[model samples]
Target: MVQDVTLVDGAGSGPAAARIPPAPLGRNRDFLLLWSGASMSFLANRVTTVAYPLIVLWHTGSPLAMSVVSTAALLPLLLVQLPAGALVDRWDRRRLMLVCELGRVAAVGSVALALAAGRVTVAHLAAVAFTEASLAVFYRLAERGAVRNIVHPAHLSTALSRNEARGRAAGLLGQPGGVLLQSAGRWVPFGFGVLGYLVSAVSLLLIRKDFQQERDPTAGRGRMAGEIAEGMRWLWRQRFLRAAFAYVAGTNVLFQMLALALILRVKEAGLPSATLAIVLGIGGVGGLCGALVGGWVQRRARQRTLLIAGAVAWAVLIGAMGFTREPVLLGALYAGTGFVGAVFNVAAAVYQVRTTPDALQGRVAAAAGLVGSGTNALGSFAGGLLLAAWGALPTVRAIAIAMAVLALLAAVAPDLKGELPDDGTDTDAVG
Candidate 1:
């Protein structure tokens, strides 16, 4: 007789898989609910991403004011990540997510209502955006930590890849949807976003299973500062993970610079905004395709092979951008870069999920986000400075060369290779 056994939870302890009856992920009702809810949240967030700036620009008619609003929204990432991650690990992830959605509903809905009443101001928009974005930091970290509890271990990679695709699809549609809604009415986009968050909250409420494993009573009892430091220390101790973080950080900077340079190049060539849209659309398609095929790629290739291949592809694609100004060639190169980036993202995400314990997922994610935030800001600064000083082609080539060097370094990290670790031990925490 087949014994009914519970799969090991992401916190690392439960029943052994050898004696358990496996459920196909497709039929896993709880996983489906969580997935659908997350997709809605992502879609709504993307919609607001566009609508926020549009509304600001409409109300103030000043690009400087718009930039200030954007900075206000993003500044929280640097400040909130460390503590947010710690709190997520301490709280009930499902409830945390639900509360976040409700908060978003209030924030976005307030904007809509204010616009309808002709009382919306730039200050109001900035305050709402900052508040909502702050809450989002917690919500996302909580959701990532919670994913492992809802699906089988074998399906985690597939689930994550699907999540990536959902984000890509959201990106592809959300901006256009916001623009169209804005054309109808300024409040329409925010209203649409509010509805999405409400639906998302309903989905969270419908989930029957717990979103976190039972925590050890002593695990999270330390001081908040100590807990945050512990998470960072744990992450740094993993050789491959440290390397992966560096690789991602470097590429993020490179891509940010390259993206800015592309726009400069296009404008210098007198290309229209429509052309820019087409190029971005092509990149989106590439990202979506890569995300969809990520599971297949994971199944077929070793982690080392995937990372190395993706790195090489990025090097080639970015390097090629410097050699041509043809919009079609530039677009194709950009798309290729996006495809490789997606592959790397899936592989890195699987690595992170498999190796880290559920308890520390939030802190680790937050620490990583904190690092990326700094690097991305530096990248934006450097991109504009470099393009202005050296012109587009030369700056593009310099950035590509720097990126290729990083990729080469990543290709040789021994800890990043072979099969996923099977010992089921979080190197930092035995539980």
Candidate 2:
């Protein structure tokens, strides 16, 4: 069972008493446990993400080997999302999360042990990376569904904002932490992953709340394909969500192109590689700050407002990038975009969680994730081609033009006109 107690702002009567405020998320024990566990898991994932290529390059001295392992890690995002979402909906989410953490520990631990024995092969590394990533997919889907179950309805937005900030902080710290640990030993980063998963597992054990609503025993017995299709159909029927997904997909592709273009611009200008790092660090800080303020933004603005404004902001910032190659200026522009992205993410996540039924949370989230991120690889490939063909300046200017078009479409889209109610009730009505 989940506890969703409402906390009043102050002792009062009549309407004042009815105006129940949410308890601070910091005071929620179950949510704290969940957050801590997830924080560790996210940090661990980032640490290994940086270490994987480094380990392969150091041990095998083969960029091809590094690419193979990295590709293996990413394959789960493409292949596992749909099916994993289905399983997450059908399975006991808490138990599933426990299994996932244990599986990750074993997979990453195997790599550490192999490295210790001086017997790690590229194939083994690839297999471990794939397995670890696959488990992470399941864990992430389960966690997404579990969030709404653990907090009061009034606190959901704030909870999600904190989660977003945690992820940004992890990204900010994890890569450098990975590199520092690897300097201590090739196996040290993987050992850190093992420890992180163990901590996550322990936290899961301490949580007293259920991660989801009780399911009707007869439901979810359909074939996996059928379940997946049902989820897809539900998402397709939401006019606002459909429009939002399209916007996200387009912006994601454009961002990918911009990232690659930024690197090329720096290289072409004969800047030191550290300049790129400083720019990215600035962007990460900006994202963290945006996430920290996301709750405030969400409470004050409508979903449509955030979406349209974010698209417009991104367009302006990216357009500005086309006019400058200075490291500090590029960093500032990139950071602005990052801020907008984080705020948008928080708003979108709250809308999705508040509207979708608990039974469909995992499937809907997975489906939405696939639609949003499925084109990332295509975007990266296109970015490479565009950079090769037109050089960095022209490619960025072209992307800016495309983004402005996206912003225009967002402003005029009919489905994006009104605000969706966020009363935390599950409904099938189209937004």
Give a tens-digit lDDT track for model 1, residues 59-112: 889998898788878977998899999999998999999999999999999999
The residue-by-residue lDDT of candidate 2 on 213-302, one tens digit each, is: 766989988999999998888777676787888889999999889999999999999999999998999999999999999988999998
Estimate TM-scores for all models. Answer: 0.93, 0.94
Best by TM-score: 2
Task: Give the alpha-carbon lDDT of every model.
Answer: 0.81, 0.87
Give, for candidate 1, the lowest lDDT window spanning 10 residues. Answer: 1-10
How many clashes in candidate 2?
0
Native-vs-model 2 lDDT?
A: 0.87
